[model samples]
Target: MSLTKEQTQHLYHKLLDMKKELSGEKKETESMTEEVGELSNGVDNHMADHGTLVTDRMTDQTVREIDRELLEEVNHALQKMKDGTYGVCEKTGQDIPYERLKAVPYARMTVEAQADMEDELETDAPSFEREFHEQVKDLSNKETVDQKSSQTYEILDREQDSK
Candidate 1:
């Protein structure tokens, strides 16, 4: 289901507000990063100072990346609103509640759908240890099957020879 005109307008305002806020945040992040710029003064700065600078730079980088991604989501949500697809769960094609939309104007999926997507994402990455163990177990099982087949064949040959 689609949103009512009033709901659409409300969400549109909410999204625009979010866009403005995110833009400001992105600008702030940019300034923070510019101030924390390169590690070129390695020789002049004390080791602890340099370490602190590097740590701050790393933290700012992560923040910048997160803000950038959020900006993209906000932009996408705005576009969806323009395209008349807002307030509908992207995964289920059902209307999202006004409360939910108010809480997260950029939400593309319903809570249940989002949870399911997260579950799928979490399960997609197999742990290296488990994968390695499974591969080793499979190889050993194949070898065991092959050895049993050979032993069975040898027993059959001995019976034929006795006959």
Candidate 2:
């Protein structure tokens, strides 16, 4: 079902409110990212504590990245609202359910489309558990090689001693 005039107005206001909040948060994150400094690039004189600067830069970059992504979503939603296509699924051109919109106002697809995408992601990528187990196996193989190398070294040492 399509949204009524009242519902559309309501959602528009909600989107604006969310956009304002996200923009403010994005500004804060950007300032923090700037303060994180250019330790790697040698732009800032962080010679006193290079380690702490690197750690802080990594953490700030992560936060800034999150904020930038959210800001992009919020901006896209605002543009869709301006284009009179808000609350409509971009994939199927169907009116997205209000419940889903309420949960994620910036969503571009209907619940079914989103579920299909998630299923694809699950099938296309190796799970974290599987990757972790594979890494563990590799580490164990390295350990076994190390043990054999140590044994070979000991055997050579014994031969030299007997000579």
Candidate 3:
């Protein structure tokens, strides 16, 4: 299934809104960084001033990261729209429900797939750590399989057995 003209227009508007928001955030981050740099170059500040500076810098970093990620997502969605593949799940290759897309215009995964992925990522105490470990484990498993496959005689023997 594909998005109708109305739906596409709605998504376009949403994309515009997101772009505006991201632009504003980028400006704010830049301004904050400039202020921080100027303050750092100035004479010794009070404890409160230093604390506020640290907090502002941290917030700026987080906002910039979020803006960057959102911009990438919006770009991907725009590309999909151009290719006539918008509203489709990247993982499942199925049309994502209209409501879901409306709610999250930058979504790349279907609801089910997103939930499953989230659950998998959150199964451990530290979700990011768990996700990293899982990725490493997958790479290791692939390497082991490739090593075994490099033994051509063993592979041929296995193939003959299967036949």
Query: Whose TM-score is greatest here?
Result: 3
Which runs of model 2 end up more than 4 angstroms from their true locations? 25-53, 126-163
Note the Cα lDDT for every prediction shown: 0.70, 0.68, 0.74
> How would the candidate models be sorted by lDDT, starting from the highest?
3, 1, 2
What TM-score, computed on C-alpha atoms, does each candidate reach? Answer: 0.63, 0.57, 0.64
TM-score of candidate 2 against the unseen true structure: 0.57
Question: How well is each residue in 54-77 modelled by candidate 3, as lDDT tens digits?
Answer: 777775675466567778899889
Higher-scoring candidate on TM-score, 1 or 3: 3
lDDT of 2 by residue, 51-88 (tens): 66666666567556555676798789879888888888
Off by over 4 Å in 3: 28-45, 124-163
Candidate 2 — which pairs collide?
A: none
Cα lDDT, model 2, residue 148? 34
**Residues 90-158 of candidate 1: C-alpha lDDT, one tens digit per residue:** 898988887888887888899999889867755775666544444333433436444535443455578
The lDDT, on a scale of 0 to 1, for candidate 1 is 0.70
Error of 2 at 37 (Å): 11
Worst 10 residues of 3 by lDDT: 133-142
- Scored by lDDT, the top model is 3
State which candidate, 2 or 3, has the greater TM-score. 3
